[model samples]
Target: MRISTFLNVHLVSDSTGETLNAVLRAVAPLFEGVTPLEHSYYLVRSRRQLDRVLAEIESFPGVVLFTIAAHDLRDVLVDHCKRLGIPALPLLDQVLTMWEHHLKMRAGEKTGSKQALDENYFRRIDALNYTMAHDDGQMVHEFNQAEVVLVGVSRTSKTPTSIYLANRGIRTGNFPLVPKAPIPQALLELNKPLVVGLRVSPDRLIAIRRNRLLSLNADATSEYVDEDAVREEITDANRLFERQNWPVIDVTRRSIEETSAAILNLLADRNAK
Candidate 1:
């Protein structure tokens, strides 16, 4: 049997703590048999807030990652961690220092710069709104307004992938490809948006559909979860995708992030052409 180890990880930030959480997620999977228990402290700007965070750090006594713009607060946090014999790391200092060196200028001492209410922030919000409005083949007539359109049968992760792309300010819309149903004419006539098809292995699709039915307490013995029927459904979807000449992504072994990245790369390639 494999052994498992649980580690306490403290993330302290003067902002929303998004960066620290992202970094922790990216690095935690690199180690086998180790699971990180996250202790997040956001908006740690004041000394009192730092004191509380430091107290928690002392209590847990684990790895600490911080992204504090103020030098004084950072110094206090680091010094406290040192006293407790805990490893402390500044997540953004190295990148900021490198940029400062390259530009021959000091980095600004501002907290939550990444979460600023800038044009890009508003654009992301707008994209999210658009994505929610156009989800599941809704607003088909406005497909022309989307940057990316995802088409896939049920349980292929079209909605989540569309939302993920929208979070990055790419206006995304997804439509479900129903078996024995005609493809929407609006989807076929789309000229602006880059339409991509998401597909999965027959076995994976069946498993997912089974779980979905179990969750809803619905009948699980229908054609939806039938092995042969699922295979035919996937085959039909693949044929439709091929006939439309749309790019297809096999999502059997791909995460939503990975699928979104592939879609973005496809969009980039299309723009380049």
Candidate 2:
């Protein structure tokens, strides 16, 4: 007597629920008009840990999608779902099984093998460190060494986009466009790196700066949050972008990925030409 338009899904993972969520993102769009209500359980490695999730699954029985690599724990989850008359699918099992057969080798004896401490992880760490060192134009001497430079006024999504680029192996540096501060000569002198400017709407910048000040428990009555001053700031930044002939991205409504994609496209075009 159970009928539903939406599917209840439990995403269980050993480490962060990133893997299972990513897989679901790829597959869920195929079934149109079907909404998935996801209950994500991360770091579920023990029976006691899974007991709460199992209780929830029994109440609204539906599909269980997981990326659990621990064999015994995986079996326990599958068996419990079976008893509830709920179907279970381990997203990584088929892919890993095929790799095991192809490579003529058994997989490692650990869950979350993809998150192993290795060379690629170290590279990411190094990139993170480099991003931190060069953030907010602190290390101007290293500006020439960057793969990409993000220049923008406050709350233009400069720092987050720079870090995102860094995580993708691009050594990114971001400098804030202060109202009257001098632009870095090193940035203008850089010959090989891509320089991208980020801009946001004055209203959006005002709202963002207001919230930021509130978060810091500081007064929000400064010129930083004034709409007119913010509008002038944006105008000046745009003028700088035009003066330098740097590609500009409007981050008012764009996600970090979208902004970065546009910057990446610019880099590709500049390199190609």
Candidate 3:
């Protein structure tokens, strides 16, 4: 195995450092064996905050990525990095410049513009509230209000996927398929929402359940983690999906993001139809 090399990376943002972190994560893997040591500073809107951040950067001396909307603050950061002989980059400057050129206008000076309390932000909040309310088969009578409903056996990642979809302003809910329990009538009758079934391999399900049980300090010998029982559960879930004519996604090797993306595609196709 190749030895790992660590590189210090400084991320400064006037708002949440989500964009910087995401960009770093996307690019870091391309350089094999190089691990990033992240130093993230968020909400660097004031000069004082920027001063503290600069101190940290100077001490560590790393590649700097920032998304400061204030021009003066950005200038100070860039100049300081230049004097220190460290590389400083604005993450959104190129994209914003391209948009400005295309639209024949300069970008606004507003800080943390993406986090503004706009209609889309409110919509995402509403969707998140609805998702939390309807998670794990809760509020089944209101299932029709959801844009998408996920159905799956235990440990198939129903809850996390539902939340992820909700974050994208898609009202999502999920219901678990327990062994020997009859399917909820409300779920079966959800005509308005696109009901998607999540399926996982029996072996993967057992491993997940075993880890879950260990985390909870619960008995691992229960039928919940039994290989035969898990197999039967998955098979029954698959059959139910086929009987109901619902879309099914295998989550055995899929991340929550991947599963949610598939569900979004299914919802888009349904909407088109």
Candidate 4:
């Protein structure tokens, strides 16, 4: 069994660590089954925590990945990991270098291209930075500024979809629709936003809700996880979306990326009109 340990070193000033986390989370499943990997993430924002995580890395085997923000700290971590005989990968540095070289090469090879690509490139970087800061409800106002809003019952991939859209330069807000609860008055008047409602098959929903209730040590019985009630809630939500002309997405079969891409495509079509 090939076991590897993963460590994440963050910066106190790093505003985009959340975006890096999302990508790593999406790729985590790839390391399962064959090359077994056990990992722990350290959110190091202080010098004391950084020193502690570095010392801890010496006792663990395999890779040490630094989602580093500061250039000086990245050099220190890399040297330390190297001395400890662990492979260290600095993600931000590699990506930025790749992007810079790619754009520079493209500009040099293109005809009549202005130097204004720098502004666009930096803007994209800023967008990604903003995305990291806004992820996980940190920037709820940014969510409200989204061109697309995702509404779901719960665990229907609202958070994942929102993060995915953020990575692709789209601001996305998500709100869960509670059973028998009134829709937010603001949402009812959200004519400027493209709202998308998500649904899943009732059986699937029942299983998911039941598991959730059990995990929370709550009543996993009739009212909350009942199949009939779930079906009715789904139906009602679908009808509400249709009546309001909001695009509906069935998340039962689609992965988070696929569902997010579909929503983005829909928004793109609307913009084209």
Candidate 5:
């Protein structure tokens, strides 16, 4: 039987006011094929909005998963969903239960590690903002602080990977590989951090390039996105990375999170050196 699911995550945050975005980011992989009918707002700052949201839930069809944390609000949301005859799943109910169980089973899951991770996360955010603000997407730097440097063609998931790495407490820098363009002289001398060059299959890169050009209302098919040219560029990039003894990862099937996790694992291994 084909299964269809709909999710309506109602996030509640008292201080940070970022619970919704956090939940969405966490659950992004789950909504790949599901259609998003609508998104409703019911901020805690506005009690009136909460009432309206409760009323609106009555008209909502099918299953709607809510991600609320406020006690009274959670009760109200569950009641409203039941009144509408819709299935609702609470956000942190079973998740925290399982997490607690896992934590109890693990060895040396100390508070110190958690605190260190939190501190590292904020530092990563600062670095990311700096990178974005200073980025021309072409300029190169010393990148001495980078734990791992990502090299890929345009839109080959370099920037997102860098951001993901940063979030995982790995300072990541990225450079684009343009065909026949000179790489920064400084980059050639880097012998410290592991450099991972990302490669996508030529056909996939062509499709991505085609969609990008069409979105910008530019030529849908050009030498820039030519399959042969992209293939050659990937080959050359791989050769360069090989010549420099940098590791290469074909990112054709990996998500940004997976790529970042792999990089972190590499760093962890290196630190044991």
Candidate 6:
């Protein structure tokens, strides 16, 4: 097997690692192919915690990215990484230096400041709650309350995509289009929700379902992975979407981000009209 190449990055922080995580997510995608295996050491405010984390870094040597506000802890991590022959970066160090030099102001060096308890945070929490509760058409009665509704066949990335949208403060609900099952009645009554459908090719559907079955050690006797059955399901779903006049996204070759972008475009177009 060709093992996937990945970067072993240690994210050290004095508080919650949310800012560091967001930075990594935004920057890592710029580099193609290789993924990051993150080793997060959060709330390391003392030399004692640093001692344990430094030992772990030595055992599994990798580049380290830290958001430590303490000078001694940062120095310890940097010196340890230097001795181990690896790169260590302090995120926002240069920016903080620039502000101190030019603006003549010293930062508070506080942690979790970006995640203040405010209206925006509350909106995200509410969206997350709504998304989780309405997953897989659980709360069908709340269909009219959703900002967006995603309907797709099993394993078509519905749940993950819906959760990602929720993180963006969008109230999303996803429903599965099981073979031979009727569409939900509440779905037809969605007036304000921007309902969208996801479709995939039969071959890809069969491959995904087969791998899913193998992962679960499931019986292959089920029609879930049958190519003909999947094709029929896709056809029926396409027909249903057409009758309902909802936007459709073909996710056979699209990633979750691309699919979400397309949905956003469709929503923007709908709003424009």
lDDT of 3 by residue, 90-143 (tens): 999999999999999998887775666789889999999999999998999999
Q: How well does candidate 2 match the true structure in TM-score terms? A: 0.74
Model 2 / residue 230 / CA error / Å:
3.9
User: Lowest-lDDT window of 10 residues in candidate 3?
Assistant: 109-118
Two-way lDDT contest, 1 vs 2, winner: 1
Error of 4 at 72 (Å): 5.3
Task: Provide TM-scores for the models.
Answer: 0.94, 0.74, 0.94, 0.56, 0.68, 0.74
Model 2, 1-273: lDDT tens per residue?
545479888999888887788878878888877788988999888889988889989887889998787788888888998888899998877888999999999977576555756677777777788888999988877877788889999788888998888877778889998888888788777766788889788888898899999999998889899888888998998998998998888999999988988888888887798
Task: Report the Cα lDDT for residue 111, model 3.
Answer: 78
Of candidates 4 and 3, the better by lDDT: 3
Off by over 4 Å in 1: none
Candidate 3 has an lDDT of 0.92
Encode model 5's per-residue lDDT on 131-225: one tens digit a residue. Answer: 55323233456465566778888878888888766665566678888888888876777777677888788888888889899899998667779
Q: Which stretches of candidate 3 lie over 4 Å from their true place?
A: none
lDDT of 4 by residue, 105-178 (tens): 42121111232255654554555565556443344445555566788786787777877776566656677777
- Which residue window of length 10 is worst by lDDT in model 4? 106-115
RMSD of each: 1.6, 4.7, 1.6, 8.3, 5.8, 4.4
Expressed as tens digits, the lDDT of each residue in 1-273 for candidate 6 is 656678888999887888789888998888777788889988888899999999989888878888888788888889989999989998888989998999898987665545446688888899999999999979888888888999988999999999888887889999998877877788877899999999888899899989999999999768898777778888998988999998889999999988888887887888899
Residue 145 of candidate 5: its Cα lDDT? 53
- Candidate 4's C-alpha runs over 4 A off are 1-23, 34-54, 67-76, 102-146, 151-189, 210-233, 254-261
Whole-model lDDT per candidate = 0.91, 0.85, 0.92, 0.67, 0.68, 0.87
